[model samples]
Target: MSVYVGNLSYQATQDGLTQAFSEYGTVKRVQLPTDRETGRMRGFAFVEMGTDAEEDAAIEALDGAEWMGRDLKVNKAKPREDRGSSQGGWDNRGGSRRY
Candidate 1:
């Protein structure tokens, strides 16, 4: 399981996240998504720790805690929902069949 960390500063970096989370336990991975168009940090990250206990500790310690000028939203990362194909739309092309 991974931890979802939100409300991060745009300047937050993978190294910074790793360092912060490492205090709780071993930080296995840190994924900071970037905006496709602008190529900027998305203000959130996913941190995978070595153990569930470490993740729990990080979440409990960081949630609602101020860091990098923002209050963090730390929690368990939820499974990604599958967005099925749009081929079944009204027009069968992902759009409404309007007049």
Candidate 2:
């Protein structure tokens, strides 16, 4: 399980997140996604801790806590939903069909 941390400053870094979360327990990983076009931090991150207990502790402690000039939105991360394919619009391919 992992924790979702939101409302982060654009300047926040993985090391900073690791350091902040490490106080609760061992931090396994920190993922900070970025904008594909601009290549900028997305103002959120996912932190994987050693155990659920540690994650809970960190969540309880950090949620709504002000950090980096923003209130943290910490909680368990929801499983990623499969987005299927990117070509989900009207089928314009050349195919003959009676209307």
Candidate 3:
């Protein structure tokens, strides 16, 4: 299981998260997503710990705690939903329409 950390500063780094969470237990991985177009931190991250106990400890301690000048929102990460194809709203097929 992974923990979802939200309300993080744009400047927060993976190393910083690792250091903080490591106090609870071994940190397996840290993922901080970035904006595709701007390449900036998305103000959130996902952290995977060695065990669920570590994740619980981190979540309990970090949730609503101020870190890097922002209140952290820490909790278990829900599985990502599958967003289907990229085809947008417009219909491509040409058809005659009488107004």
Q: Pick the candidate with the highest lDDT.
A: 2
Best by TM-score: 1
Stronger candidate by lDDT (1 vs 2): 2
RMSD (CA, Å), each prediction: 3.3, 4.1, 4.9
Please give, for residues 28-82, the per-residue lDDT of candidate 2 as tens digits.
Answer: 9999999999999999999999999999999999999999999999999999998
lDDT per residue (tens digit) for residues 1-99 in model 3: 799999999989999999999999999999999999999999999999999999999999999999999999999999998764465453345643333
Segments in model 2 whose C-alpha atoms lie over 4 Å from true places: 85-99
Q: lDDT score, residue 52, model 1?
A: 97
Residue 58 lDDT in model 3? 98
Clashing pairs in 3: none
Give the poorly placed runs of model 3, Cα more than 4 Å off: 85-99
TM per prediction: 0.87, 0.85, 0.85
Clash counts for all predictions: 0, 0, 0
The residue-by-residue lDDT of candidate 1 on 1-99, one tens digit each, is 899999999999999999999999999999999999999988999999999999999999999999989999999999998776545357546777544
lDDT at 74 for candidate 2? Answer: 100
